[model samples]
Target: MERDFYTFCTAMKTLDIGSAEGRGMSPQNYATIRLALAACYGKLSKGRVGSSLELTSEQEEHRERKGRHYCGLKEKGKRKDHERICIPGVAAAALSAVVFARMRHSSLEVLLCGLSLFDVLVLSSTLLIYPAMNACQNEPDPTNSRVCHFFWRSTLIAYPLSLIAQAGSVWTCVAITFDRFIAVFFPIKKRVWATPHTSTYIICGVAFFSVLFKLPAFFEITLNEYGQITPSSLRLDATYQLVYMTYMYLIFILLIPWTVIIVLNGIVIQKVREAYRTHKRLTQRNTRGRRDTDERKMTVMTIVMTGIFVLCNIPPAINNIIESYAPQYRDRYRHRIPLSTLLVCVNSASNILIYCWFNRQFRRSVFRLCSSAAYKRRASEYIRASKEASMSQTLKNKL
Candidate 1:
């Protein structure tokens, strides 16, 4: 069968070439069709020898180049990597942002603002760059315009915006932790930090500071002739790699912020424990139990969110630290970046779930929002039933 098919294709090729020339087809068009036919023939004659099976040096070189993959192009075994991560992350972030928008007036408004903002940033950046990222993962052609343009734009431009959003998210958590600490340890100052207005200011300040800090990243990235993103020529220097890259990630982004989060949350937990013990001793009644339950729920929510943030961020943070010192690891780290990004998106998106789980008020609000139309329909039905009953009674009285 293979031999027959090969002969058939060979015969078709000769006939087509001869016809192309006779039919007044341009040399360029004929050449293209010839190459296409050749490639098709190559597939059909994979195991056979002679003209079809023997690839030229140049052809072999092209094949080798196609096989050459960057880390971003790799998949998790046979599974798709980017779509699995980016799509879900974008969805979760969007849902969380929408859900949390209703709870803006709460004491935790500042944290919610930060979280929602981060979600929006993630949504935008992910959507803007998802095509490019997906293409880079799946397609080999670096010359793809959408891949080059969107990927470079996302990485070089939108990425820094995401960085600011991320920093704001971190600082927001830090602020919440600190607020909880103050509320527990120093009650008098709780009013100052935990207020909605104060949270707004803090959120704004975080945004401002993050923009200021992440500005350096914008200048450090550039696109090559093929539209692939690479570090700036200036960033090739040892000083930039050692000082700015290393310290920027290790000290400022990861170490200090993470340390502050851990310490503050730890204190908040300790204080919570003390309060629980005191509350238990003071009241054996169910009323106090309800309050205690509420407190416990909030504590659980905070812990879960903080835990997820830390866990999801660990890989990227470690890579940052390592890549800071050893520049060679940067390429290897790119392979894992999509996974890291997915983790962060999940973390950002899960906050709404945590809110619904932990806060009764939030749950009620969400329920009311979701079931508002149903509630109205029920009310209208009840009114109609009452009117019908009254009319029946009136007619019966008249009779």
Candidate 2:
């Protein structure tokens, strides 16, 4: 995550603007904070003014000074070498692809590239390879085997869909992280950095990134059909998905952004507490209330994203790390199984909620978008009636 910022900064330095240090720093810092905020909080503020902010109840958990730290994560599944390959590595790879792909120049090129790859993969797998592989497989004679057909279909669709979803999840996380990074680091010069146009560009970039990211899965995932043992998708021979996913979780998620989220949340939380303390002490800091509120909103978002990443990915990351030994008793706790699944699903689908949580403007915009035409008509009538009353003499004259 930090390297991305540094790379962005380096690119800016090449522009050779006379002394507009702010101009160069604007895009670089904005990009850094783009993912930071995207992962943690919500959408970029489109309004020209400071946005209406809503604080989350989750902010209380982060309010506690000494938050819990992760020791290790555990997984409980019987050791099947092939089963091991299917879930985690594939999941990680798809996410990594989305994260890496968005960094390229433009989303148009990205969409084209991604669409082309998606089509190619769909064509090759669906048309030629699948039918041929099914025909040649162990139960080739069993046309009555509907189970085999369904299984092959799953093998074709499920893994690819998972890869696609991961691409989205990664891009979403990246988008959140970048947004928060800008909020935290560049508080003074906010809009100068994160513009609506830039936000749209970044989001489109994320979509494209997912395409490129998922493209590689075609090479890795293949169907295994062994004598009616219920065929499955497996990563052919790769130890690690050996792509951007590993680099991303290792560098981007776990190491870099998680660290940044933690530290920034801590600082903002502490600052909020300090604002409480300083207000209590000097009694003049409530004047700092609006500024502090913005910071607190940022902190709330930071905390939420941190908690989400920690709760969702940490267990999986730990499970992956510990599975190095592929230890026994990996499946002892039935209690955590549901938690892990829920967290992962929630983590992937969470960006929309985070936006609604932090940005009242986003909420209003969404509400307005979803508002009924009837309601608008009613609102228009009310406004027109009020205007007529205020200009009662004009209404009488017009009548």
Best by TM-score: 1
Taking the tens digit of each residue's C-alpha lDDT, what string does model 1 give over 213-327?
8777777888765555767876788887788777776777778888988988887787777777777776456875776567566665776788788888897787776666666
lDDT of each: 0.65, 0.45
**Which stretches of candidate 2 lie above 4 Å from their native place?**
1-151, 167-175, 208-214, 224-234, 238-249, 275-295, 324-339, 348-358, 373-399
TM-score of predicted model 1? 0.69
lDDT (C-alpha) at residue 164 in model 1: 77
Positional deviation of residue 248's Cα in model 2 after best superposition, in angstroms: 6.9
Question: Model 2 — TM-score against the truth?
Answer: 0.46
lDDT of 1 at 131: 51
What is the RMSD, in Å, between candidate 1 and the native fold over all Cα?
Answer: 11.2
User: TM-score per candidate, in order?
Assistant: 0.69, 0.46
